[model samples]
Target chain A: MSDRIRIVVLLFPAMLIIVVLFFGGLVVGLMRSFNYMPVIGLTEPNLQAYWSVFTDQEFFLSFLLTFHIAFTSTVISSVLAIGAALLLRRRFVGRALVNFLFQLNLTVPHLVGAIGILYLFSQSGSFARLAAEWGMIAGPADFPELIFDPYAIGIIIQYVWKEIPFIGLIVLANMQSIGEDYESVARSLGATRWQAFRYVLLPLLLPGVLSASVMVFAFTFGAYEIPALLGANFPAALPVLAYRKYTDVDLAARPEAMAMAIVIALLSAVMIVIYLRYSRRRIRD
Target chain B: MTHVSIQSLTKTYPGSSEPSLDNLSLEIASGELAALLGPSGCGKTTTMKMIAGLLEPTSGDVTFDGRSVLRDKPEHRGVVMVFQNYLLFPYMSVAENVGFGLKMRKVNKVEIDNRVNDMLALVKLPGLGKRKPSELSGGQQQRVALARALIVQPKVLLLDEPLSNLDAHLRFEMRDLIRSLQQEMGITTLFVTHDQEEAVVLADKVALILDGRMKQYDSPDVFYKRPVDKATARFFGGQNFLNGNATNGQFKTSFGVLDLPIDCRRGTGTLTFRPENICVTGKTTETNTINAQLVEKIYLGTQTRLKLAVGTEFIHAVVNPAEVENLEQGQRVNIAIPPESLWVLTS
Candidate 1:
């Protein structure tokens, strides 16, 4: 057999599964949102579901809250990752230990991480218990609701913790491949340490950092587990809102749920599009 | 005035026993260009880095105008190094790369632009400022690195094998360019290179180092004529070395007794001379003569090189190409070593 034909034959099954499971599901969800689902006895297609979901005040609040959490977490995580990467670029005594500790999250599930956050920062959790014992607060209620708050502070904190090492790994790889010449050359040219980092290494590291940030933003925007556990009821994140809508008892709400799901998917698609465009432009330059 | 002085500078890597650079001291006058010529891993670059305040010395101190600079950082030492790779920032344009040092000093934008332009013009890269480093040719990139190092007006300039990266033709061109630029700027400079011909051609003084130890330091003219040892002589393209016993103004060798210029004690020493100085003669009426057979002959256009065996000792010689055009291998010839061209070494 020809090499090209054999290679194509080997790759065909995986590609077929991915296309059916991912894009096929997206297409079916889009069609169902338009009221074309024969399984639910919906006969006619209309824009009623999209219009209703777009006009819903609760849905709008959820969308905005999701955006807020994603944006804040991504920015903070990316900056911290860049700092950590720079700090660890030079080998030190404890560098291996630090690297191993941070990368430990990569294998641990995000759901587990969110629950861990719940145990640490929830109203009656370890932090409040410690605070109460230390006389920092009178009781669990006085500890302030960090988790399940309207701000989604718990979700943002968890996202930042989980995504920093991901972005930091990418940034550190870029730093290593560039070696030490750029920074050394900068210092020799009368640049202070800060100036050398800002002028030389920062510009080189931006593309990696921004691309990693885009990945975190897209993932956090659609992820349901963290927001589901830590977010409040009314202004829940978009994925959580979509789940609640999808599980409603009234059958008429199926179309609205699917519409919201499509919108969440659309948000991730838009983020990915921006990442590709921005990275392509950088590559061309 | 001595612009820079390194006093007993030594560097030993953590895992190594012998020091990479051992008790090295040298002085460079203002506006003089000195070349630290050595083979790879001979501590030339280490010495330059120590002077630049990039690498800390194991023991001694470096000073500029009689003040110790060991306490100062590399940024404040007024020392600039143009690395061998010509590490131009790929993200920045040529003008920005040249203006980077000035920007670090917080010079105003207008002054930076003006100085950048002037320095670019000085390096013969005028009006090419808008282009990025990737767009420029290798020679142009080298010019940008030079312009960048010079724009800051450093007190001392260090060039680490600046021309070693260029092609042979560009090497000569950049060599001349470096000469003119160093003369015009009048900055005290230390250049590190392994190429002996480059050192002799470009430097006012050459310090030849070997195995992390300095063998000789003098003007290129003096080093070429009188190398301090056999290693230094061999480094500067020496091939013919004859060990002989010397007494008074004469030397006893396997072939014959030869006359000498320096006062020689009663002991044995090695005789060294350049290949081109050993001439071929039909008969030696002047006393220093030997019958040798030509083993190999290589005609290098202007000069014909030949290895001759005299009493089981091989001596390499270069002759005028026209005179030895018909000379063939395995032929017998008479070789002569004149008194003035011979230098005696103990080892």
Candidate 2:
């Protein structure tokens, strides 16, 4: 009994955080989403907010936009990550510096990464000035609009830039542990370099690549800050739309905002379930 | 004619001054299965890797059929190595593993399948081709690796301790299997082993290497009967050594003097012989006889190992069990070291 008491006491802080910030907040959000705001005299339990959000063409477009942004960024990041990991697996001069450059952004907040993307790709950013100096364009106005565009190109660049090294680290670790013996054996047996890589290293590297890709996809699917900062005003990402509606001045708009937040949470939950299933198929001995 | 010539081969790993293989040179004849015998850290595997192009040498060239292959890519170099661990691709089925090289060569699917089946049958794993490498037994996995390498018809086949992982019965079985397979295929093979018996029995010629240098290269009979040096003599089971001074044809030792049957320089030398070669008898009258007191006798059916004490030296002799059956422990016996049986090792 005392041992159980000790464990419970040790876990009390973490459990309190989970209950108050996670589940307790989730319950409040759910109640508000169902039109149960007693303070505003709307106490009847109903699914009107869900129906409104589902029928709203803007909401539907934002949801699709969110999916498109996450999916595109994830696919691009996975390809770049696999290529970088394969290249870095070999010993080369300045590899340490390259690895350090990748890790430098890893721990920085996503907001910071989004700001970096905006600075590099904004109309009046350094790239435009350099292009102007080179006489490639007339002025900063002639620079292409990459950030805050309807295509969400800036949001994608931010997410992909941050996630590539994250996924590459996981894959490089797996490939290094697998060693180069199998490739050497293949070469000894008259396999050309590309043939050896395709028939041997690719099969061995697939499981690691796929598992890391799942993590990358799940993370980008629910990411809020980068999309909120870089996405356009109209077809905002799901998280950005929910956050914008939550901060609106109208008191009655909170319920719809709660509904969108609930939808985002549910979609993230589904992604986590799928990710767990894929993770269980991890490489076996 | 030499099929594989490793001329002045040396490999010094980066940041190391001492070479792993120091200017080593050896020639392997066409269709000859040669065993590269050495103790651990003797650069046998290094030499083999240099030939396979898996590892580049610091200085030297390896040629197949008088053509230099040092600059060739490993895929172009028609050399294959069956590594120590039998590295069968874990994700591939046995048949797929065997067919990989053929697939790389752009062989037709039908031809690849046919050759894979035939190769599986050749390695005695015919019907088990669909099983993954992890599912096969150690011996079966080894065969799969062998078949995978052999299906490509490499110009030089390198076998690196292929039977080391097997149990005793399987070791002997695979030993015979490998020998017969090599003979049937007529592949010029380089077999690396630390096992002296495996080196002697498995190869048409044995090259005994020590400290990354070749000590002796000769037939197995020469290795056993007339080893070139002390290392080869000891490695090839030279159990008895009588250090003495040689004057003319006679070697004078503390125990007794024995006549050297072969021509020897009149100086200090060592007489080397196997225990079984020295005959222990009750009567002795002539050359190469040692009169010693029988100290101990171990009766191992068909042969009795006798530990004889002469003056201050002990000589081990293996005689017929029947001859030593009735001998007492302190009986005087004469051990005849026949001149032909003794190898006068000068160094």
Compute each candidate's TM-score over C-alphas.
0.94, 0.88
Every model's DockQ: 0.78, 0.77
lDDT of each: 0.88, 0.85
Model 1 chain A worst lDDT run, 10 consecutive residues: A276-285
Best by TM-score: 1
lDDT of 1 by residue, B88-178 (tens): 9988899999999998899999999999999998989999999999998898899999999999988999999999988999999999999
Clashes per candidate (backbone, < 3 Å): 0, 0
Q: Highest lDDT: which candidate? A: 1
- Each candidate's root-mean-square deviation in Å? 2.7, 3.7
True contacts kept of each: 0.84, 0.91
In model 1, the Cα lDDT at residue A70 comes to 86
CA lDDT of B313 in candidate 2? 84
Q: List candidate 2 segments past 4 Å from native.
A: A1-51, A93-102, A249-285, B263-267, B293-308, B317-332
Cα-based lDDT at residue B40, candidate 1 = 95
